[model samples]
Target: MKEKGFRYSILASGSSGNSFYLETGEKKILVDAGLSGKKISQLLAEIDRQPEDLDAIFITHEHSDHIQGVGVLARKYQLDVYANQKTWQVIDQQNLIGKLALEQKHVFECGKLMTLGDLDIESFAVSHDAVAPQFYRFIKDDKSFVMLTDTGYVSDRMSDLLANADGYLIESNHDVDILRAGSYPWATKQRILSDKGHLSNEDGADSMLRTMGQKTKRIYLGHLSKENNIKELAHMTMTNHLLKADIGVGQEVKIYDTSPDNATPLVTI
Candidate 1:
Protein backbone atom coordinates (compact mmCIF):
# COMPACT_ATOMS: atom_id res chain seq x y z
CA MET A 1 0.00 0.00 0.00
CA LYS A 2 1.14 3.53 -0.73
CA GLU A 3 1.92 5.98 2.04
CA LYS A 4 -1.11 8.10 2.81
CA GLY A 5 0.58 11.46 3.33
CA PHE A 6 3.71 13.50 2.68
CA ARG A 7 6.60 13.46 5.11
CA TYR A 8 10.01 15.10 5.66
CA SER A 9 12.93 15.25 8.07
CA ILE A 10 16.11 17.23 8.46
CA LEU A 11 18.87 14.65 8.29
CA ALA A 12 21.54 17.11 9.38
CA SER A 13 21.68 20.88 9.66
CA GLY A 14 24.48 23.30 10.47
CA SER A 15 27.40 25.14 8.88
CA SER A 16 29.20 21.80 8.72
CA GLY A 17 26.54 20.43 6.35
CA ASN A 18 22.83 20.47 5.44
CA SER A 19 20.48 17.89 3.99
CA PHE A 20 16.79 16.98 4.14
CA TYR A 21 14.80 13.91 3.28
CA LEU A 22 11.51 14.79 1.57
CA GLU A 23 9.07 12.22 0.29
CA THR A 24 5.56 11.86 -0.95
CA GLY A 25 3.98 8.52 -1.66
CA GLU A 26 5.46 8.56 -5.13
CA LYS A 27 8.77 10.43 -4.79
CA LYS A 28 11.85 10.72 -2.60
CA ILE A 29 14.24 13.68 -2.95
CA LEU A 30 17.07 15.36 -1.07
CA VAL A 31 17.10 19.15 -0.88
CA ASP A 32 20.90 19.37 -0.47
CA ALA A 33 23.82 17.01 0.21
CA GLY A 34 26.54 19.13 1.78
CA LEU A 35 27.94 16.43 4.06
CA SER A 36 30.28 13.68 2.85
CA GLY A 37 28.61 11.02 0.73
CA LYS A 38 29.31 8.41 3.39
CA LYS A 39 27.71 10.52 6.10
CA ILE A 40 24.72 11.33 3.95
CA SER A 41 24.31 7.65 3.13
CA GLN A 42 24.43 6.79 6.81
CA LEU A 43 21.94 9.50 7.65
CA LEU A 44 19.59 8.15 5.01
CA ALA A 45 19.98 4.70 6.45
CA GLU A 46 18.88 6.05 9.83
CA ILE A 47 15.58 6.89 8.18
CA ASP A 48 15.42 3.46 6.50
CA ARG A 49 16.35 4.84 3.08
CA GLN A 50 19.37 4.15 0.91
CA PRO A 51 21.33 6.61 -1.22
CA GLU A 52 20.36 4.68 -4.33
CA ASP A 53 16.67 5.29 -3.63
CA LEU A 54 16.70 9.07 -4.09
CA ASP A 55 14.87 10.37 -7.12
CA ALA A 56 16.80 13.65 -7.36
CA ILE A 57 18.64 16.40 -5.52
CA PHE A 58 17.54 20.04 -5.48
CA ILE A 59 20.62 22.22 -5.01
CA THR A 60 20.00 25.48 -3.12
CA HIS A 61 23.38 26.90 -4.08
CA GLU A 62 26.97 25.84 -4.76
CA HIS A 63 28.24 26.48 -1.23
CA SER A 64 30.33 23.57 0.01
CA ASP A 65 28.02 23.18 2.97
CA HIS A 66 25.18 22.58 0.52
CA ILE A 67 26.61 20.67 -2.42
CA GLN A 68 29.70 18.81 -1.24
CA GLY A 69 28.23 15.35 -1.68
CA VAL A 70 26.39 16.02 -4.93
CA GLY A 71 28.92 14.31 -7.14
CA VAL A 72 29.28 11.19 -5.08
CA LEU A 73 25.56 10.64 -4.60
CA ALA A 74 24.76 11.25 -8.24
CA ARG A 75 27.56 9.12 -9.62
CA LYS A 76 26.96 6.30 -7.19
CA TYR A 77 23.22 6.14 -7.65
CA GLN A 78 22.78 7.47 -11.18
CA LEU A 79 20.33 10.01 -9.76
CA ASP A 80 19.20 13.19 -11.47
CA VAL A 81 20.42 16.50 -10.01
CA TYR A 82 18.82 19.91 -10.52
CA ALA A 83 20.12 23.45 -10.01
CA ASN A 84 19.97 26.76 -11.81
CA GLN A 85 22.34 27.58 -14.66
CA LYS A 86 24.58 29.81 -12.58
CA THR A 87 24.91 27.22 -9.83
CA TRP A 88 25.79 24.57 -12.40
CA GLN A 89 28.31 26.90 -14.02
CA VAL A 90 30.06 27.75 -10.78
CA ILE A 91 30.15 24.15 -9.58
CA ASP A 92 31.81 23.26 -12.86
CA GLN A 93 33.94 26.41 -12.98
CA GLN A 94 35.38 25.94 -9.53
CA ASN A 95 35.58 22.15 -9.80
CA LEU A 96 33.68 22.17 -6.55
CA ILE A 97 31.29 19.26 -7.02
CA GLY A 98 31.97 15.96 -8.78
CA LYS A 99 31.58 15.38 -12.45
CA LEU A 100 27.96 14.57 -13.17
CA ALA A 101 26.90 12.88 -16.38
CA LEU A 102 25.29 15.10 -18.99
CA GLU A 103 22.14 13.08 -18.83
CA GLN A 104 21.85 13.60 -15.07
CA LYS A 105 22.32 17.38 -15.21
CA HIS A 106 19.13 19.46 -15.10
CA VAL A 107 18.52 23.17 -14.63
CA PHE A 108 15.46 25.03 -13.42
CA GLU A 109 15.39 28.78 -13.50
CA CYS A 110 14.49 30.87 -10.46
CA GLY A 111 10.78 31.73 -10.34
CA LYS A 112 10.00 28.73 -12.50
CA LEU A 113 7.95 25.68 -11.56
CA MET A 114 8.60 22.04 -12.19
CA THR A 115 6.81 18.81 -11.45
CA LEU A 116 8.27 15.62 -10.06
CA GLY A 117 5.92 12.70 -9.76
CA ASP A 118 2.79 14.15 -8.12
CA LEU A 119 4.45 17.15 -6.54
CA ASP A 120 4.87 20.65 -7.92
CA ILE A 121 8.11 22.39 -6.91
CA GLU A 122 8.81 26.11 -7.01
CA SER A 123 11.99 28.03 -6.32
CA PHE A 124 12.37 31.65 -5.24
CA ALA A 125 15.41 33.90 -5.06
CA VAL A 126 16.86 34.59 -1.61
CA SER A 127 19.48 36.93 -0.17
CA HIS A 128 22.65 34.86 0.13
CA ASP A 129 26.29 35.18 -0.87
CA ALA A 130 26.38 32.33 -3.34
CA VAL A 131 25.42 32.57 -6.97
CA ALA A 132 21.72 32.03 -7.64
CA PRO A 133 20.73 31.09 -4.10
CA GLN A 134 17.17 29.86 -3.90
CA PHE A 135 14.71 28.10 -1.58
CA TYR A 136 11.94 25.75 -2.48
CA ARG A 137 8.21 25.17 -1.96
CA PHE A 138 6.60 21.83 -2.66
CA ILE A 139 2.88 21.29 -3.09
CA LYS A 140 0.90 18.12 -3.52
CA ASP A 141 -2.65 17.08 -2.83
CA ASP A 142 -3.57 20.36 -1.09
CA LYS A 143 -0.42 20.30 1.00
CA SER A 144 2.40 22.87 0.89
CA PHE A 145 5.87 22.30 2.34
CA VAL A 146 8.90 24.59 2.32
CA MET A 147 12.61 24.58 3.03
CA LEU A 148 13.75 28.20 3.46
CA THR A 149 17.21 28.49 4.91
CA ASP A 150 20.78 29.73 4.23
CA THR A 151 19.45 33.19 3.44
CA GLY A 152 20.06 36.42 5.29
CA TYR A 153 16.39 37.35 5.10
CA VAL A 154 13.06 36.28 3.73
CA SER A 155 11.56 39.28 1.99
CA ASP A 156 7.90 40.31 1.99
CA ARG A 157 7.57 39.39 -1.66
CA MET A 158 8.77 35.91 -1.00
CA SER A 159 6.77 35.65 2.23
CA ASP A 160 3.54 36.16 0.34
CA LEU A 161 4.61 33.51 -2.10
CA LEU A 162 5.20 31.05 0.75
CA ALA A 163 2.52 31.91 3.29
CA ASN A 164 0.02 29.31 4.53
CA ALA A 165 2.39 26.39 4.17
CA ASP A 166 1.52 23.23 6.04
CA GLY A 167 5.11 22.87 7.25
CA TYR A 168 8.32 24.96 7.09
CA LEU A 169 12.01 24.38 7.77
CA ILE A 170 13.46 27.88 8.17
CA GLU A 171 16.83 29.18 9.34
CA SER A 172 17.55 30.40 12.83
CA ASN A 173 21.26 30.62 12.18
CA HIS A 174 22.73 32.81 14.95
CA ASP A 175 22.08 35.10 17.87
CA VAL A 176 23.08 38.69 17.19
CA ASP A 177 24.68 39.43 20.56
CA ILE A 178 26.29 36.02 20.68
CA LEU A 179 27.62 36.34 17.16
CA ARG A 180 28.98 39.80 17.84
CA ALA A 181 30.69 38.69 21.05
CA GLY A 182 32.09 35.41 19.69
CA SER A 183 35.75 34.91 18.86
CA TYR A 184 35.43 35.09 15.13
CA PRO A 185 37.33 37.75 13.14
CA TRP A 186 35.61 40.99 12.22
CA ALA A 187 35.42 40.33 8.48
CA THR A 188 33.88 36.91 8.86
CA LYS A 189 31.45 38.22 11.42
CA GLN A 190 30.38 41.04 9.13
CA ARG A 191 29.88 38.61 6.27
CA ILE A 192 27.47 36.58 8.40
CA LEU A 193 25.50 39.74 9.22
CA SER A 194 25.55 41.24 5.78
CA ASP A 195 22.55 41.54 3.48
CA LYS A 196 23.68 38.32 1.86
CA GLY A 197 24.72 36.60 5.09
CA HIS A 198 22.80 34.26 7.36
CA LEU A 199 19.84 35.28 9.49
CA SER A 200 20.05 35.77 13.21
CA ASN A 201 17.62 34.14 15.60
CA GLU A 202 15.68 37.35 16.02
CA ASP A 203 15.23 37.78 12.30
CA GLY A 204 14.31 34.13 11.89
CA ALA A 205 11.62 34.37 14.53
CA ASP A 206 10.20 37.41 12.82
CA SER A 207 10.19 35.59 9.53
CA MET A 208 8.13 32.84 11.03
CA LEU A 209 5.68 35.29 12.50
CA ARG A 210 5.22 37.06 9.20
CA THR A 211 4.86 34.04 6.96
CA MET A 212 3.09 31.63 9.27
CA GLY A 213 -0.63 31.36 8.79
CA GLN A 214 -3.56 29.62 10.42
CA LYS A 215 -2.99 26.66 8.20
CA THR A 216 0.71 26.46 9.07
CA LYS A 217 1.06 23.52 11.41
CA ARG A 218 4.76 23.18 12.14
CA ILE A 219 8.10 24.99 12.12
CA TYR A 220 11.52 23.32 12.31
CA LEU A 221 14.32 25.78 13.09
CA GLY A 222 17.42 24.81 11.09
CA HIS A 223 21.00 25.77 10.12
CA LEU A 224 22.05 26.96 13.59
CA SER A 225 25.62 28.21 13.97
CA LYS A 226 27.60 26.05 16.34
CA GLU A 227 29.59 28.92 17.81
CA ASN A 228 26.97 31.62 18.15
CA ASN A 229 23.58 29.99 18.61
CA ILE A 230 22.53 27.60 21.34
CA LYS A 231 19.75 25.11 20.77
CA GLU A 232 17.82 26.37 23.79
CA LEU A 233 18.30 30.00 22.79
CA ALA A 234 16.88 29.45 19.32
CA HIS A 235 14.02 27.48 20.77
CA MET A 236 13.06 30.14 23.30
CA THR A 237 13.48 32.97 20.84
CA MET A 238 10.96 31.50 18.48
CA THR A 239 8.67 30.36 21.26
CA ASN A 240 8.53 33.77 22.85
CA HIS A 241 7.77 35.41 19.55
CA LEU A 242 4.89 33.06 18.89
CA LEU A 243 3.61 33.53 22.42
CA LYS A 244 3.47 37.29 22.00
CA ALA A 245 1.48 36.82 18.85
CA ASP A 246 -1.00 34.56 20.64
CA ILE A 247 0.14 31.63 18.56
CA GLY A 248 1.04 28.83 20.90
CA VAL A 249 3.78 26.56 19.66
CA GLY A 250 2.29 23.33 20.91
CA GLN A 251 -1.31 24.34 20.61
CA GLU A 252 -1.41 26.02 17.22
CA VAL A 253 1.85 25.00 15.63
CA LYS A 254 4.55 22.48 16.39
CA ILE A 255 8.11 23.90 16.54
CA TYR A 256 11.28 21.86 16.82
CA ASP A 257 14.96 22.72 17.09
CA THR A 258 16.60 20.56 14.46
CA SER A 259 19.98 19.06 15.34
CA PRO A 260 23.09 19.68 13.33
CA ASP A 261 24.28 16.14 14.00
CA ASN A 262 21.15 14.01 14.07
CA ALA A 263 17.90 13.50 12.23
CA THR A 264 14.74 15.21 13.50
CA PRO A 265 11.55 13.26 14.18
CA LEU A 266 9.78 12.40 10.97
CA VAL A 267 6.93 14.88 10.42
CA THR A 268 4.21 13.46 8.28
CA ILE A 269 1.47 15.54 6.70
Candidate 2:
Protein backbone atom coordinates (compact mmCIF):
# COMPACT_ATOMS: atom_id res chain seq x y z
CA MET A 1 0.00 0.00 0.00
CA LYS A 2 1.19 3.51 -0.67
CA GLU A 3 2.25 5.56 2.36
CA LYS A 4 -0.40 7.89 3.59
CA GLY A 5 0.02 11.67 3.58
CA PHE A 6 3.21 13.16 5.05
CA ARG A 7 6.12 15.17 3.63
CA TYR A 8 8.96 16.79 5.58
CA SER A 9 11.78 19.20 4.75
CA ILE A 10 14.37 20.80 7.00
CA LEU A 11 15.06 24.31 5.86
CA ALA A 12 17.99 25.11 8.12
CA SER A 13 19.40 23.56 11.27
CA GLY A 14 22.34 24.47 13.48
CA SER A 15 23.40 26.96 16.16
CA SER A 16 22.73 29.70 13.61
CA GLY A 17 19.04 28.92 13.01
CA ASN A 18 16.45 26.15 12.51
CA SER A 19 13.21 25.65 10.64
CA PHE A 20 11.20 22.92 8.88
CA TYR A 21 8.28 22.45 6.55
CA LEU A 22 5.81 19.65 7.37
CA GLU A 23 2.87 18.79 5.18
CA THR A 24 0.07 16.37 6.01
CA GLY A 25 -1.06 16.08 2.37
CA GLU A 26 -3.73 18.65 3.18
CA LYS A 27 -2.12 21.01 5.62
CA LYS A 28 1.26 22.76 5.58
CA ILE A 29 2.89 24.17 8.69
CA LEU A 30 6.29 25.50 9.75
CA VAL A 31 7.83 24.06 12.89
CA ASP A 32 10.14 27.07 13.46
CA ALA A 33 11.42 30.13 11.62
CA GLY A 34 14.83 30.90 13.10
CA LEU A 35 16.51 32.50 10.11
CA SER A 36 15.73 36.01 8.90
CA GLY A 37 12.30 36.65 7.38
CA LYS A 38 13.67 37.19 3.89
CA LYS A 39 15.76 34.05 4.14
CA ILE A 40 12.84 31.93 5.27
CA SER A 41 10.65 33.30 2.53
CA GLN A 42 13.27 32.49 -0.04
CA LEU A 43 13.63 28.97 1.31
CA LEU A 44 9.89 28.45 1.14
CA ALA A 45 9.90 29.55 -2.46
CA GLU A 46 12.67 27.08 -3.19
CA ILE A 47 10.27 24.31 -2.15
CA ASP A 48 7.44 25.80 -4.22
CA ARG A 49 5.68 27.00 -1.06
CA GLN A 50 4.97 30.57 -0.04
CA PRO A 51 4.58 32.22 3.34
CA GLU A 52 0.88 32.62 2.78
CA ASP A 53 0.54 28.88 2.20
CA LEU A 54 1.36 27.97 5.80
CA ASP A 55 -1.41 26.89 8.13
CA ALA A 56 0.55 28.02 11.19
CA ILE A 57 3.98 28.40 12.77
CA PHE A 58 4.91 26.52 15.94
CA ILE A 59 7.69 27.78 18.22
CA THR A 60 9.53 25.11 20.16
CA HIS A 61 11.13 27.52 22.66
CA GLU A 62 12.24 31.09 23.14
CA HIS A 63 15.87 30.72 22.11
CA SER A 64 17.01 33.25 19.53
CA ASP A 65 18.17 30.51 17.18
CA HIS A 66 14.60 29.19 17.15
CA ILE A 67 12.56 32.38 17.35
CA GLN A 68 14.58 35.00 15.49
CA GLY A 69 12.23 35.09 12.53
CA VAL A 70 9.03 34.09 14.32
CA GLY A 71 7.70 37.59 14.83
CA VAL A 72 8.70 38.58 11.35
CA LEU A 73 7.04 35.53 9.79
CA ALA A 74 3.88 36.07 11.80
CA ARG A 75 3.73 39.70 10.80
CA LYS A 76 4.24 38.93 7.15
CA TYR A 77 1.86 36.02 6.83
CA GLN A 78 -0.55 36.94 9.59
CA LEU A 79 0.08 33.35 10.54
CA ASP A 80 -1.07 31.65 13.71
CA VAL A 81 1.95 31.33 16.04
CA TYR A 82 1.77 28.79 18.87
CA ALA A 83 4.04 28.46 21.87
CA ASN A 84 3.74 27.59 25.53
CA GLN A 85 2.85 30.52 27.78
CA LYS A 86 6.32 30.79 29.28
CA THR A 87 7.97 30.78 25.86
CA TRP A 88 5.61 33.46 24.66
CA GLN A 89 6.42 35.62 27.66
CA VAL A 90 10.13 35.19 27.08
CA ILE A 91 9.91 35.99 23.39
CA ASP A 92 7.77 39.04 24.07
CA GLN A 93 10.24 40.35 26.65
CA GLN A 94 12.97 40.33 24.01
CA ASN A 95 12.53 43.32 21.73
CA LEU A 96 14.98 42.18 19.09
CA ILE A 97 12.32 40.25 17.15
CA GLY A 98 9.69 42.12 15.20
CA LYS A 99 6.08 42.44 16.37
CA LEU A 100 3.33 39.89 15.84
CA ALA A 101 -0.34 40.71 15.45
CA LEU A 102 -2.82 40.09 18.29
CA GLU A 103 -4.83 37.66 16.22
CA GLN A 104 -1.76 35.66 15.32
CA LYS A 105 -0.87 34.76 18.91
CA HIS A 106 -1.77 31.32 20.24
CA VAL A 107 -0.63 29.60 23.44
CA PHE A 108 -0.28 25.85 23.83
CA GLU A 109 0.50 23.96 27.00
CA CYS A 110 2.99 21.13 26.95
CA GLY A 111 1.41 17.65 26.59
CA LYS A 112 -1.89 19.11 25.63
CA LEU A 113 -2.93 17.70 22.25
CA MET A 114 -4.20 19.91 19.45
CA THR A 115 -4.92 19.63 15.76
CA LEU A 116 -3.89 21.40 12.61
CA GLY A 117 -6.01 20.33 9.69
CA ASP A 118 -6.25 16.53 9.90
CA LEU A 119 -3.07 16.02 11.87
CA ASP A 120 -3.11 15.63 15.66
CA ILE A 121 -0.12 17.44 17.19
CA GLU A 122 1.17 17.04 20.73
CA SER A 123 3.93 19.16 22.25
CA PHE A 124 5.92 17.44 24.99
CA ALA A 125 8.45 18.86 27.41
CA VAL A 126 12.14 18.25 26.66
CA SER A 127 15.32 18.61 28.71
CA HIS A 128 16.58 21.97 27.54
CA ASP A 129 17.58 25.15 29.31
CA ALA A 130 14.83 27.23 27.77
CA VAL A 131 11.91 28.22 29.99
CA ALA A 132 9.52 25.81 28.28
CA PRO A 133 11.52 23.55 26.04
CA GLN A 134 9.35 21.12 24.07
CA PHE A 135 9.20 19.04 20.91
CA TYR A 136 6.37 17.90 18.71
CA ARG A 137 4.59 14.62 18.03
CA PHE A 138 2.32 14.73 15.01
CA ILE A 139 -0.04 11.97 13.97
CA LYS A 140 -1.96 11.68 10.77
CA ASP A 141 -3.86 8.69 9.42
CA ASP A 142 -2.28 6.56 12.14
CA LYS A 143 1.23 7.49 11.02
CA SER A 144 3.37 9.04 13.76
CA PHE A 145 5.97 11.74 13.04
CA VAL A 146 8.18 13.75 15.39
CA MET A 147 10.80 16.51 15.29
CA LEU A 148 13.13 16.82 18.30
CA THR A 149 15.98 19.33 18.49
CA ASP A 150 18.09 21.37 20.94
CA THR A 151 17.76 18.61 23.51
CA GLY A 152 20.60 17.83 25.89
CA TYR A 153 19.97 14.18 26.74
CA VAL A 154 17.31 11.57 26.21
CA SER A 155 15.37 10.22 29.15
CA ASP A 156 13.81 6.75 29.19
CA ARG A 157 10.40 8.25 29.27
CA MET A 158 11.30 10.40 26.30
CA SER A 159 12.64 7.42 24.39
CA ASP A 160 9.43 5.50 24.97
CA LEU A 161 7.41 8.56 24.09
CA LEU A 162 9.10 8.81 20.70
CA ALA A 163 9.07 5.19 19.63
CA ASN A 164 7.44 3.93 16.41
CA ALA A 165 7.55 7.20 14.55
CA ASP A 166 7.36 6.80 10.80
CA GLY A 167 9.75 9.74 10.50
CA TYR A 168 11.87 11.63 13.04
CA LEU A 169 14.17 14.66 12.97
CA ILE A 170 16.36 14.41 16.10
CA GLU A 171 19.24 16.58 17.19
CA SER A 172 22.74 15.13 17.17
CA ASN A 173 24.46 18.25 18.38
CA HIS A 174 28.11 17.37 19.05
CA ASP A 175 30.75 14.77 19.66
CA VAL A 176 31.61 14.61 23.35
CA ASP A 177 35.35 14.10 22.87
CA ILE A 178 35.65 16.75 20.17
CA LEU A 179 33.52 19.15 22.19
CA ARG A 180 35.78 18.71 25.22
CA ALA A 181 38.93 19.44 23.22
CA GLY A 182 37.40 22.18 21.06
CA SER A 183 38.05 25.92 21.39
CA TYR A 184 34.77 26.71 23.15
CA PRO A 185 35.31 27.90 26.73
CA TRP A 186 35.15 25.52 29.67
CA ALA A 187 31.80 26.92 30.77
CA THR A 188 30.41 26.53 27.29
CA LYS A 189 31.57 22.94 27.15
CA GLN A 190 29.93 22.26 30.48
CA ARG A 191 26.67 23.68 29.25
CA ILE A 192 26.73 21.54 26.09
CA LEU A 193 27.37 18.44 28.19
CA SER A 194 24.80 19.28 30.81
CA ASP A 195 21.52 17.39 31.08
CA LYS A 196 19.64 20.46 29.91
CA GLY A 197 22.02 21.38 27.12
CA HIS A 198 22.49 19.73 23.70
CA LEU A 199 22.57 16.05 22.92
CA SER A 200 25.91 14.51 22.11
CA ASN A 201 26.14 12.33 19.00
CA GLU A 202 26.34 9.18 21.07
CA ASP A 203 23.27 10.11 23.05
CA GLY A 204 21.35 10.89 19.89
CA ALA A 205 22.31 7.62 18.22
CA ASP A 206 21.42 5.59 21.30
CA SER A 207 18.05 7.26 21.48
CA MET A 208 17.42 6.31 17.85
CA LEU A 209 18.29 2.69 18.56
CA ARG A 210 16.05 2.54 21.61
CA THR A 211 13.08 4.21 19.98
CA MET A 212 13.21 2.82 16.46
CA GLY A 213 10.85 0.10 15.39
CA GLN A 214 9.97 -1.32 11.98
CA LYS A 215 7.56 1.57 11.64
CA THR A 216 10.40 3.98 12.24
CA LYS A 217 11.76 4.29 8.74
CA ARG A 218 13.25 7.75 8.28
CA ILE A 219 15.74 9.46 10.60
CA TYR A 220 17.15 12.91 9.93
CA LEU A 221 20.06 13.98 12.13
CA GLY A 222 19.78 17.68 12.84
CA HIS A 223 21.16 20.67 14.79
CA LEU A 224 24.80 19.65 14.54
CA SER A 225 27.51 21.82 16.09
CA LYS A 226 29.68 23.71 13.61
CA GLU A 227 32.63 24.23 15.92
CA ASN A 228 32.69 20.79 17.48
CA ASN A 229 31.15 18.41 14.96
CA ILE A 230 31.35 17.96 11.21
CA LYS A 231 28.54 16.42 9.11
CA GLU A 232 30.62 13.36 8.20
CA LEU A 233 31.65 12.84 11.83
CA ALA A 234 28.09 13.04 13.11
CA HIS A 235 26.79 10.71 10.39
CA MET A 236 29.58 8.19 10.98
CA THR A 237 29.07 8.23 14.74
CA MET A 238 25.39 7.38 14.40
CA THR A 239 25.83 4.73 11.69
CA ASN A 240 28.71 3.03 13.51
CA HIS A 241 26.87 2.82 16.81
CA LEU A 242 23.78 1.43 15.17
CA LEU A 243 25.79 -1.23 13.35
CA LYS A 244 27.49 -2.25 16.61
CA ALA A 245 24.08 -2.65 18.20
CA ASP A 246 23.06 -5.03 15.36
CA ILE A 247 20.63 -2.50 13.96
CA GLY A 248 21.59 -1.88 10.38
CA VAL A 249 20.81 1.66 9.27
CA GLY A 250 20.30 1.09 5.56
CA GLN A 251 18.58 -2.25 6.00
CA GLU A 252 15.41 -1.18 7.76
CA VAL A 253 16.01 2.55 8.35
CA LYS A 254 17.08 5.39 6.08
CA ILE A 255 19.11 8.21 7.60
CA TYR A 256 19.98 11.67 6.34
CA ASP A 257 21.68 14.78 7.67
CA THR A 258 19.94 18.13 7.83
CA SER A 259 21.56 21.24 6.39
CA PRO A 260 22.81 24.30 8.20
CA ASP A 261 22.49 26.59 5.15
CA ASN A 262 19.95 24.99 2.81
CA ALA A 263 16.82 22.88 2.78
CA THR A 264 16.88 19.13 2.49
CA PRO A 265 14.87 17.67 -0.37
CA LEU A 266 11.23 17.06 0.52
CA VAL A 267 10.75 13.43 1.46
CA THR A 268 7.26 12.02 1.52
CA ILE A 269 6.22 9.47 4.13
Assess every candidate by TM-score.
0.98, 0.96
Residue 112's lDDT within candidate 2 is: 89
lDDT to native, each model: 0.90, 0.86
Lowest lDDT sum, 10 consecutive residues, model 1, at 1-10
lDDT digits (tens) for residues 1-269 of candidate 2 = 64586887899999899998888766888988889989988888878888888878999998888878887778877789999999888888876456777788899899889988778899999989989898898887888888888888878898888888898888899988899999999999999899889988888988888887879878899999899888998899888987898776898887898887888888777
What would the C-alpha RMSD of candidate 1 be, to one decimal place? 1.1
RMSD of each: 1.1, 1.7
lDDT tens digits by residue: candidate 1, 52-144: 878999999999999889899999998899999999999999988868789999998899999999779999999999989988998887888
Clash pairs, model 1 backbone: none
Model 1 TM = 0.98
Highest TM-score: give the candidate number: 1
- Candidate 2 C-alpha RMSD relative to the actual structure: 1.7
The lowest-lDDT stretch of 10 consecutive residues in candidate 2 is: 93-102
